[model samples]
Target: MFTNIRKFSAVVVTSGAALALLSACGGTDSASMGGHDMSTMSSSAPAATAASAQPSATFNDADVMFAQMMIPHHQQAVEMAELADTRASDKEIKDLAAKIKAAQDPEIQTMQGWLTAWGKPMPSGGTDHGMGHDMLGMMSEEDMKKLADAKGAAFDKQFAQLMIAHHNGAIEMARTEQSQGSNPEAKDLAKTIEAAQQAEVEQMRKILKRL
Candidate 1:
């Protein structure tokens, strides 16, 4: 009887120890799960800064002035080119006007966009370039009216002369841009304008001689 009671006591002790070990294991698992939760908790993400967003092109005051002045200047050239129908009789003169319009119209838009992107004001429209001004070779109201009233050989001759002068003014402005402007794109455009207008000036001079 004593032997059976000793075996029963031993079995009870072993079961109690096993139960304690199971409870400890469960506690350890709960603590480990809580640590995982803590690891996941963090502050919200940061807001996007202006620098992180898209950047604007770099430019300077000279570039701004170039675009501002050139916009209106190109507009006038396009307008003069459009007057070829009533004011041009030479087939070459008419073709040249059309070409000028085609080139300058888009160039005007591009300059306007540059001003807007740079957060600058657009220039007011006018053709009253005074004597000794940088905006030389711009036609006066009287000059345009005279060309509009002429026809045949007179129209052809007047158009050639005025357009030649107009191109020279553009070349001067472009040279200023090329020399002092800060924007790479604007400078490149200025260079292109100088070359193309110089060529056109020569062509117009030749046309004038023929007329």
Candidate 2:
């Protein structure tokens, strides 16, 4: 009977040890699975953040065309404004030209930036891409030459007249942009251009009367 009890006790102890070992293995497996889950969550978070951080390329074709066409348009205006510094006799004309140059130079750079961001081509070398005189208010090469040759009162009158026409053309373009453009920034700029150029046009008309 004593020998039977010793054998039974050994069997019970061995079974208990096996159960303990199994419990430890189960705990290790649960910890490993939890670690894997945590790692997956951490990795996915950065990927989500990266996706959200990327710039929204929400621009449409109208935005592209507006930027492309306006760059050259602004460039020509700046050129005309530059001529006023040397050729214009009226103090008002000179001041107006300076203002035009200052406003348009920055605008040209801004439009260029938009084109670059959109992966669209810029107007080459400040030249309209065959758009030429067909573009509203664009002076022909001949017109530009005449302005370049004139001085004093002739320069001031011609400059004011040409600039007035140019501003009208710009206002028309801005109106089109406001109607058609999808990008918020581009539409906002179009509105600004329309209002500002309209005011300038009125001012120029007043100046024309004086001249």
Candidate 3:
């Protein structure tokens, strides 16, 4: 009877060891399953972020020049436009001035952003005519003085004529940029300036006839 009891005890101990081994194998499988899920989650997250992001556009040197030169050019136009607001008597002339200011101001900011991005200066300073006749389509000191001093219909007529010439000069510069400018943004802006200024030129000519 004692021998029989010993054999039964041995059978129970062996069964307990087998149960422990099965439990350890199950724990390892659970950890492996959790690790696999974590890896999948990590891999998918970056793809979601990339899908949501916006792609940036590229630019070149011609684009940079177009932005830089046009900023100051537009500034000068804005200044002239403001003068028309205060000094012009004709409603049409004032309207034209306002239009010029509205169009060029935003463009100036756009150019400044380009310059900042391009790591370039505001004006490259290759052309310097001072206050002389050499300046391209620029109003002389005397010309500005005349505009500042004129009154009523005379001021309106003169502003329209001078601005027509100014727009023409801008068109010429834009054409140069179109042909020679290396940057895409600059070339595109040049084309825009050419088209818009040409339209304004025709409008100014019509205004001159009415005046």
The number of the candidate with the highest lDDT is: 2
TM-score-based ranking, best first?
Answer: 2, 1, 3
Looking at model 1, residue 121 earns an lDDT score of: 78
User: Which ten-residue region of model 1 has the weakest summed lDDT?
Assistant: 36-45
Clashes of each: 0, 0, 4
Off by over 4 Å in 3: 1-61, 124-135
Q: Stretches of candidate 1 above 4 Å error?
A: 1-56, 128-134
After superposition of all CA atoms, the RMSD between model 1 and the true structure is 34.6
Candidate 2 scores a C-alpha RMSD against the true structure in Å of 30.6
Q: 101-164 in candidate 2: lDDT tens per residue? A: 8777767666677777777776555332122334445565667788999999999999988888
Worst 10 residues of 2 by lDDT: 36-45
List lDDT for all candidates, in order.
0.60, 0.61, 0.55
Which pairs clash inside model 2? none
Candidate 2 yields a Cα-based lDDT of 0.61
